[model samples]
Target: MPIKSLLILISLLLFTQNIAAKEYKWSNKLTFLGFLKKHGIPQKTYYKMHKEDKELIQEIRAGQSYSINRKKGKITTINIPVSDELMLQLKNSKKGYTYKYVEIPYDLIERTISIKMKYGFKKDLYRATKTWYYGKELEEVYSKSIPFNKMRKGDRIILFYTQRYRNNKPYTSPQIDACLIEIKGKPFYGFLMDNEKYYDSLGRQYKRTYTTRFIRPVPNMKRISSRFTHRRYHPIHKRYRPHLGIDYAARSGSRIVASSKGKVVFKGWKGGYGRTIEIQHANGLKTLYAHMRGYAKGVNRGTYVGQGKTIGYVGTSGRSTGPHLHFGLYKKGRAINPARYVSKPSAKTIKLKGKAYNKLRKLVRHYRPQFRETRARKNSIIKKESKKCLNCFKKLPPRKK
Candidate 1:
């Protein structure tokens, strides 16, 4: 009885295999000689193709696969293969005119991946393989393990994915088994085959690339005015005043913050820039805050302000302007646009916080002391990696405005 059952199972498997391997059938009949007469495929093409591949013409029979090129409603050429002996016979026979095989185009698909960044971090589902370019050949590139965070905005990345075509048509579903993110600063890259192995665009692969960088929070963050441009003739003045600062048009009394850990070098009134405050940051870089309504209590000429600490409120105290904060940056005593240095907070800030907070809340609801160990582990990892950041690269001295 066991032997009989095994035999039945093996037969069923073989039947299934045969069904899967079945060749596709043409939905309708297509002409070979008629197609050639209409397409004007040169006789040399068939002769050359058959001479090199003798079995090509003979093997092409009714219901067999072949390509036809048509112009208007006429067939100009036909290609058929003949075996070596048959080829000679056909050449000699008066009934056989001349024949040639034209090159048949093979289908190829190109896939594009777009990683959208919001203030330089992953915010939404990074799009993969949204558009495809179809051609006879596909361009592909790959790089060995590369760090992700090293990639900056507008950096070009050539990712790789595998595809197969059948009967000169692209398969609707593609196997996107891997991708390679290449950038000049990245350290490593590799394929992500299985779901378990896949990482987000800025996952652990980028952690090391962003070393020594901490989240520099903007205190009472406000919108920025005046984008950096070469032809920046002043918006208000109309004449070129060499706009050194990025205007943040905010309501009066909006808080102004220290960009980094720094000490106030110059405070109080200065020519043209009414209530100006200059904070000399570490490494010889300085941040100048102009047009302040009032200064924070205890923030004076020598006061030390921590990174992101509010030091004053936005106001129009300078050179006759409406309520706004004229934020300026000077390094090595030359002005540069402050807009280039600032970025909005990333989605990771909210996502990481949400994950930890939700987990903690769940533990609290259950009143489980066992969850304490999980919390401790999470905190330990955060503490170890907290100080390491992506922006810790030494600042280059500012260029003249």
Candidate 2:
């Protein structure tokens, strides 16, 4: 199990008579209204909230624990995490009750670890780091290129990674920026690039592009007219606004495809999004294609479509000024940057070229010195651990005298 899950499960809840703080796990079948009613909160709270905020209620998942604090037997504060980066905060005071979306504050911790395979990779990693996640991460980042199962005792694993922490407790999984796994005395390395793809010291990639769950709706856009933003001042409205999606510059009649296979939950005009289609995909992800000129035939609510299936066309609808597609991706109920999720990968392994490749090489160079100091241990790592690998030794036949 990841350390994050362990912490959440084992963490204690503090409570008192005059002042009390308690935690409760969200039930799988619980609805937002159900939660409100159970907690003695007014159901009017949901009906009064903004449309998007109302939708965010769907972000809360089953088994997720939330906190509630009370003073003098009355609720004082409540905090429920809706997403990894955002939470729903409710406050009750003499002024009355109120709730709003707030950003989740977490400290980013960067670390470097080197682990020697004393017992086994999985066992040692858990003993040293309390996580089998890194082991799987290494296996994935070096998939097809390196066989981690082939590693013998004494084989070392080094990683430069970062993780997020909230209230001194880990939540998200650690992200490894660079890794090295010594197998049979040969050093195999992987470096994470800005694009989130992994490459080796020689700039060779083993990941298949199409293997990603999500792909760009507009395959060959000329350029992104506007990128995702948290908040900005609207020129026309003269108010703070947020473009929670990417705007792809294309002709009005250009095709828009499904980012992944999913069932369409909505297909219609969505306020400022204009004509839109929302698809519910696996893992609680929903992709929105807005400002569409037209929807494809037979495409409607409850329609299931495959990845890359044409669903609509580009257009300047709603508040849009020009012909383009506004693409938004949401996980649970929070908007997320699509750059990491959307890809236009080909079938073969991707190799950086020209400036991109040059930049990658520079990054590799920066990481070289950091890991080069451990290269001296490479040869010693491949030695046989006969004590553990007893089968590795040839059976001694009875000598005939």
Candidate of highest lDDT: 2
| Runs of candidate 1 exceeding 4 Å displacement | 1-218, 229-231, 234-239, 344-401
Could you give candidate 1's per-residue lDDT for residues 112-166 as a string of tens digits?
A: 3333222332321123322443110111112112433565654333333334345
Model 1 whole-model lDDT (C-alpha atoms): 0.43
| Alpha-carbon TM-score of each model against the true structure | 0.34, 0.56
Clashing pairs in 2: none
Q: What C-alpha lDDT values do all the predictions have?
A: 0.43, 0.73
RMSD of 1: 28.9
How well is each residue in 1-401 modelled by candidate 2, as lDDT tens digits? 99997776655332256688889999977878899899998888777766445544555767888999988779998888866655788898777678865556666666667767778777777777776877767766865456667889877777777666777887666678787888876788888866256888778885633356888898767789988755434444333234567889998889999999999998997655678899999978999888799999999999999999999998877643788888888867567778656754446767788886886788778778867765455442322111111111123233223
Residue-pair clashes per prediction, in order, are 33, 0
